[model samples]
Target: MAFQQGLSGLNSSSKALDVISNNVANASTVGFKNSGTVFADAYASSLTGAVSKIQIGIGSAVQAVRQAFTQGNVTTTSNPLDMAINGNGFFEIELQNGGYALSRNGQFDINKEGYIVTSLGDRLMGYQAIDPVSGDVYAPATASVDTFRPLIVPASGVGAIETSEISLNLNLSADAEVIPTPAPPAAAIDPSDPLTYTYSTGIPIFDSLGKEHTLSFYFVRRSDVVDTTTAPPTYSEWDAYTVVDNDTSTLTHNSTIGFDGVGRVAAVTPHVTAGVTPPTNGSVFSALLGTDAVNPNVSTLGLNAITQFGGESKPRELKQDGAPPGEISGLSISRNGIIQARYSNGDTKDVGIVNLTTVRNNNGLSPIGNNYWVETPESGGFARGTPGNGMNGVISAGQVEESNVDLTQELVQMIIQQRNYQANAQSIRTQDQILQTLVNLR
Candidate 1:
C-alpha cells in the first residue's frame, strides 16, 4: 500500500517537472504562453460508499494542465509588419486546409503571391480592400466572422488616378503693366516667348492612361488700376490662359480674376469651353478620352489663393491630386489594425483591415504549435472584430510580444518538483526495507 502511494507521488511530481521544463524552454519564444500542472489527491472508498475519518490517502494523481494567457512583454523589432496587441484579442489565421486558427505571433511577411503570411505559408486572415477607391465595406465596425478573408497586398501598386484638381497659390505682381491686346496677329500669347505673358508656371498632370502631360498657366494683366476715386485705386483685372502639353485644343476655357484696391481677391471664374457649363467652385474631374467639361471635368484649376500684392510674382504653393503610376514603397499598420501600403507617387491607401477573434473560454483552446491555438468544445464560439472594436485590442506596429513564461519562477518550480520526486522514491525504498525485515521473521 505504501509502495502504491509513493509510486503515485513520483508520477505526479514527474509530470509537474515536465511542464516546468517546457515553460523554461519556451521562455524566449515569441507570443508563447506558459502552462501550469495541477495535481489531485487520491483516496480509497469504503464498501459502504462512505469515506472513514481515519482512512489514509493513496497519494496524488495528475489532474489538469492550464495555460496562462496573461499579457506578455512587448519587444520592439525592426520589421514594419510586426504587430503586438496592447490589450485583448488574437490574430486570426487561415490554415492550409481552409480551416481557421488564432495566433499572437505578429512576425509576418509578404509571400510571392502578395499574401500576408507566416513563415509556414499560412495566410493571415483579414477584411481585404477590394476596391481601391472605397476600402473595406463591412456593415459593422468590425468584420463578421464569415466576412473575413486572407489579406493580400497589391504588389504592382494601385492604379493611377488621372489628375483631376490642381491647387495653385501665388501672388501676381500689382505693378505690372497691362499687355495690349494682340493686334493684327502679333504672336498671340506664345508660351515660349516670355514677352507674351506676365507670369507663367507649369505642372505635370496625368491622363486616362497614366500618361504625363504638362499643363501651363499664363497670367496676362488685362487692365491697369481702375476706379481711381478711392485711395490706391479701387480695382485691377487679369486673364488666365491654359495650355495642356503646348496644345491649345486640349482645353478651351479662358478665365479672369479681379482684385480689389487692398490686393485682395474679389471673384474668380473657372475655365470652360464653348457650350459647356462650368462648376460652382474649384473641383477637377477627369476629361479622359472624349470627355468634356460638362461631362468629365478632368481637372479643376484652383486660384483661390491668388492675390495681386505689389511684389514680384512668385509661387507660394503648387500641388496636384493626380499621380502617374506608383510602386509599393513601404507598409504600415494602424492602432485599429488597418494595414496600408505607400506608393512612390505619394499615395497612401488601406490594403487590408486585420481581424481579431475572442472566445468565451480562452483557456479551453487547443494549442497546435507555432503560437497558434485551435478552437475546442470548451472554447465556445468566436466573437470577431477589429482592434479597439468590441472586446478586441488595439495593435502596435513594429513590435512583438515576448513569451509570458517567467524563467526564474520556472527554475524554482523545477527544483521543488525534483525534491518531491526524490522524497517519494525514498518512501518506496523504506517500505521495501520494512517488508524485508518482516520476511526475516526475527
Candidate 2:
C-alpha cells in the first residue's frame, strides 16, 4: 500500500512538471493560454459495513488540466494587419477545409489573391463589402452572417466616378485694367496668349473612363458700356471663357459676370450652345461627354461663389464631385472592427467588419494548436457579433497579444514539483528499507 501511494505521488508530480514545462515553453508564443494541473485524492472503501473515519488515502491522480483565459499583454507592431483584442472575444477564421476555427491571434496579411489570410492560409471571415444583388456597399444595417465572406482588396482599382458637380469660390481683382472690345468680328481668343484673358485657373476633371482633362477658366475684365453719369457706377462686368485641354475650338466665350460696386456678384450670363446650356445664374457650366456614351448629358460645373474684390485674383475654394480610379494604398481596422481601405485618390471605403465569436464556456473549448480553439459540446454554441459590442472586446490594430504564461510563476511551480517528486521517491525508499529490515530479522 505504501508503494502504491508513493508511485501515485510520483505520477502526479510528473504530471505537474509536464504542465509547468509546457507553460514555460509557450511563454513567448503569441496568444498562448497557460494550463495548470489539478489533483484529486484516490480513496477506497473498507470491507466492513460501517465506514471508518480514519481510512487512509491510497494515492493522488490528476483531476483536470485547467486553462487560464486571462487577458494577455498587447505588443504593438509595425504591420497594419496585425490585431489584438482588448477584452473578451475571438477572431472567427475559416479553415481551408471549410471548417471554422476561433483564435485570438491576429497576425494576418493579404494573400496573392487579395484575400486577407493568416500565416497558415486560413481565411478571415467578415461581412463582404458589396452586395451581389443590390450592388450596394455593406453598412451596419446590412451586416450579418449571410453577408459574411472573405475580404479581398480590389486589385485593379476602385472604379471611377464622372465629374458631376463642381463648386468654385474665387475673388477677382476689381482694380485691374479693363480690356477694350475687339473688332465687331472679334478673332477667337487664344488661351496660350496671356493678353487674351486677364486671369486663368485650371482644374483637373475626370471623364466617364476615368480620364483626366484640365478645365480652364479665363476671366477678362470688360469696359463698362452702360451710362455712368446718371447711375452711381453700380457694377463692373467681366467676360469669362471656358476651355478644355488646350483645345481652343471647344472654347466658349459668351459667359459674363457682373459685380456690384461693393464687390458682390449681382448678375451672370452663361454660354448657350446646341449641346451646352449653362445654369440661369451663369454659375453652372455643363461639360458634354461624347454622344455615344451611356449618359450623354452634360456634367454641371458650379462657380456661384465668385467675388470681385480689390485684392489679387485667387481661388478660395475649388471642389469637384468626381474621382479617378484609385489603387488601394493602405488599410485600417477601427475599434468597432470595421476595416477600411484607403485609396491613392484620397477615397476610403469600408471593406468589411471583423466578426468576433464569444463562447459561453471558454474553458471548455478544445485547443487545436496554432493558438486556435475548436468548439466542443462542452463549450456550447458561439454567439457571433462585431467587436466592442456587449461583452466582446474592441479590436486594437497593429498590435498582437502575447502569451499569458508567466515564466517566473512556472519556474517556482517547477521547483515545487521537483521537491514533491523527491519526497515521494524518499517515501518509497524508506518503505523498501523497512522491508529489508524485516528480511534481516527473518
Candidate 3:
C-alpha cells in the first residue's frame, strides 16, 4: 500500500511537471493558452459499507486539465492581413476536410487563388458581401453548428462606370468685345479657326466600354444685344457649338445662349442635327451621344449661377461621374471586421466581414493541434456575432495575439513539481528499507 501511494504521488508530480514544461515551452507562441493539471485522491471502500469516519485513501490520480482562456497581449505586425481580437471571441476557420475549427490566431494571408487562409492552408470563414444579383447583403438568422463560409477576394479589376452626368460652373469675361461683324453661319464656323469662337474648353468623357473621348465646347459672342444701357452691355444671343473630335457633320451648331441685363445667363437652347453617324467606340468625340442619337445636355450654362463677370474666364467647378477599370491597390479592415478592397481608380468594395464566435463554455473547447480548438459536447454551441457586437471583441488589423502563458509563473511551478517528485521518491526508498529490515529480522 505504501509503494502504491508513493508511485501515484510520483506520477502526479511528473504530470504536473509536464504541464508546467508545456506552458513554458509555448510562452512565445501566438494565441497559445496555458493549462493546469488537477489531482483527485483515490479511496477504498469496504465490502459491506463505507464508514463515515476512518475512510482509507489509496492513491492520487489526475482529475482534469483545465485550459485558461484569458486574453493575450496583442502585438502589432507589418502584415496588413494579420488580425487580433481584443476581447472574447475566436475566428472561425474552415478545415480542408470540410470541418470547422476555431482559433484566436490571426496570422493570415491571401492565397494564390485570392482566398484568405492561415499558414496551414485552412481557409478563414466569414460573412459574404453583397450579392451581385440581388444587391443585398446576407444576414444570418441565428448561430448554428454550420454557419460559416470561406472568405475569398475578387481578383479581377473593378469594372468601369459610364458617364451619366456632367456639371460645370464657369465665369465668362464681361469685358470681351462682341464680334465686329455678324459671325459666320453654323456651317461656316470652324473650331480650328480662332475668329470663329471666343472661348473653348475640353472635357474628357467615358463610354460604356470604358473608352475616353474629348467633348469640346466653343462659345461665339453674337452681335445681338439685350441691354445696351448697362455699364457692360449684355448680349441677348451667343452661338454655342458642340463638336466631337473634328467631325463637323456631327456638330451641334448654332445653339442659342442668352444673357439678362445683369450679364447672368437666362436661357440655353441646344440644337441637334439629323442623319449623323454614331461615334466610333474608341474614337475621341467632342459631344456625348444621347439615347436619341443627339448630343446630351453637357452644361448648366443657363443657371443663374453662371455670370459674365469682369475677370479672367475661369471654371470654378468641373466634375464628371465616370471611371476606368482599376486594379487592386490595397486592403483594409474596420473595427467591426468588415474587409474592404481598394482599387487604383479610387474605388473601394466590400469583400467580406469576419465572423466572431463565442461559446458559453470556453474552457470546455477541445484543443486540437496548431493552436486551434474544436467544438465539443461539453462546449456549448457558438454564440455567433460580428466583431464589436454585444460581448464580442473588436478586431485590430495588422496585429496578432501572443500566448497567455506566463514564463515566470511556469518556472516557479516547475521547481515545486520537481521537489514533489523528489519527496515521493524518498518515500518509496524509505518503504523499501523498512521491508528489507523486516525480512532480515525473520
Candidate 4:
C-alpha cells in the first residue's frame, strides 16, 4: 500500500526541516558551521535478484547530517583577545573533563589565575615561553611540540638589567690649547676650571641596583707634535680622563688618543688601560683605575672611534645595554600566533605560541556544544601545527569569524521541506479513500 511510502516521506522531510531550522537560528553565531541532511532511498528485495527495473522504492531514510567546514567571513572587533582564522585549522583548548577539544572560536581572556581562558572556563593550550622541564621562566629555551601547556601571563614584572658595557663616539677640537701638567704642591685637573680640560660631557649609566648615575669624560690636550715630514705641520695628541659625578678625585686616565697628525684624522688607535698594557703603536696610560666606582668596567673603554678635527667638540652617539623593571601594560598577537606582553618600561617579549590542529576529515568531528568539536576515529589522526604554518591558517588578531550558515538558503530549504510534508499527507489521504471504496463494494 502507499501508506508506508507516504509515512516514510513524512518522517524524512520532518528531520530535514529540523536541520534547516537549526541553521537559520544560528546565522549570527560566531564560528558556527552549517549542516545539511542527506536522505537515501529504502527498498525491499529478495536475495534471488529481483528485476532491477521492476523494483520500486519503499521509502527514504536519513543518511547523514554533515557540517560544512568552509572558511567564514572575517570581521574586525574592538577586543584584542578576539582572533579569526583566514584559511584552515582550529585552536586547541582543554576542558575540565580531563580531555581536550578543538575549536574555531577565538574569544579569550585572562582569568585571575593568569591563564588564558574562554567564556566556558576552558583554558587555551599553547607552547610556553620556556621549556616545561626547566621550570625557570626567566631562562629562554626551545619550545617542544610534544608537550602543551596553558598560556599564562607572568604575575611579576620583568626584572631590571644592570649596565655592563658602554660605547661612545665623540669628536674633539684639534685647535684646543694643551693643558700644562702640574708639578709638586699643585692639584690635578679640577673639573670647574676651564684650563683643566678642553671638552667634557657626561653619559648616563645604571648601577647594580638599577639606580641612574653619570660617567663624565674629560678631554685635555696633553701635547701637540709637529710632523715635519708632512707638507705642513699637523697637531695631534690628547689625554682622555674619566670622572664619576664630577668628582675629580675619582679620575681614571682612560686613554691617549692621537691622530695621523697630517691635517686630517687619517688613523686612530685606542690603547685601553689596565695594570699592564698590550702591545700597540702608541704609548699606553698606566694609571690605577681599581677604585670602588670604576673597578667593575674601567678597562672596557675604547676610544678607537674618537677623532681630532677643527670643529666643535660634542658626543655623536651614546649606547648602553640596560633596562629598568617593567609592569605588564598590554598584550599583542601576531599573524603567526606569537603572543607578546608589553611592559610599562617599554619592553616586550613573547609569552606564548598558539597551537593549531587539523584532522583529515572535518565532517567526522562530533560537536559537543559551545562551538567546540572533539576528534573521533572517523576523523583520523590529528596533525598539530602553529598558525600560518604548513597547511594551517593565519590568525587575525582583534577580529572574529562570522558564522558560515547562509540564512537565505536555509529559508528556501525550509519551504521545500514544508511542501514535501504536505504532499505526503495528501498521499495518505488518497490511500484511505481507496480502502473506503473497496469496503463499499464488498
Best by lDDT: 2
lDDT of 1 at 347: 87
Writing each residue's lDDT as its tens digit, candidate 2 over 1-442 gives 8888998999999999999999999999888999989899987678875567988788999999999999999999999999999999899899998789899898999999888899999999877767568554543455676777776665655778888676668998987888766886875466877887788897887778777778888889986534344333537888888777778777877577877677766667666443665554555555555554445435555656889888799999888877888988998999998888888987788877888889999988999989889999999998888888899999999999999998899999999999999999999999999999999999
- List candidate 2 stretches off by more than 4 Å: 1-5, 47-51, 58-60, 129-141, 174-184, 187-196, 221-239, 253-282, 289-297, 304-310, 326-330, 342-347
Give the poorly placed runs of model 3, Cα more than 4 Å off: 1-5, 56-60, 129-148, 167-203, 215-286, 289-318
Q: What is the lDDT of every predicted structure here?
A: 0.80, 0.82, 0.75, 0.76
lDDT of candidate 2 at residue 204, scale 0 to 100: 80
TM-score for every candidate vs. truth?
A: 0.84, 0.82, 0.72, 0.78
The residue-by-residue lDDT of candidate 1 on 1-442, one tens digit each, is: 7898999999999999999999998999999999999889999789998989988888999889999999999999999988998888999899998789999888899899878898889998887635447543222334665557888877566666776668888999998989876887565477778887899887887765566778778889878665666543549878787777787565443677777777876666655643344444342323433343223435666676788898799998888887767888998999998887788988887767888889999999999988899999999987777889877889999999999999999999999999999999999999999999999997
State which candidate, 1 or 2, has the greater TM-score.
1
Over 4 Å off, model 4:
1-3, 46-52, 129-135, 138-141, 169-202, 218-241, 256-317, 429-442
Model 3 TM-score?
Answer: 0.72
| Best candidate according to TM-score | 1
* Per-residue accuracy of model 3 over 46-106 as CA lDDT, tens digit each: 8887554777677898999889999999999999899999999999999998788899999
Candidate 2 root-mean-square deviation in Å: 4.3
lDDT of 4: 0.76
User: Residue 92 lDDT in model 4?
Assistant: 89
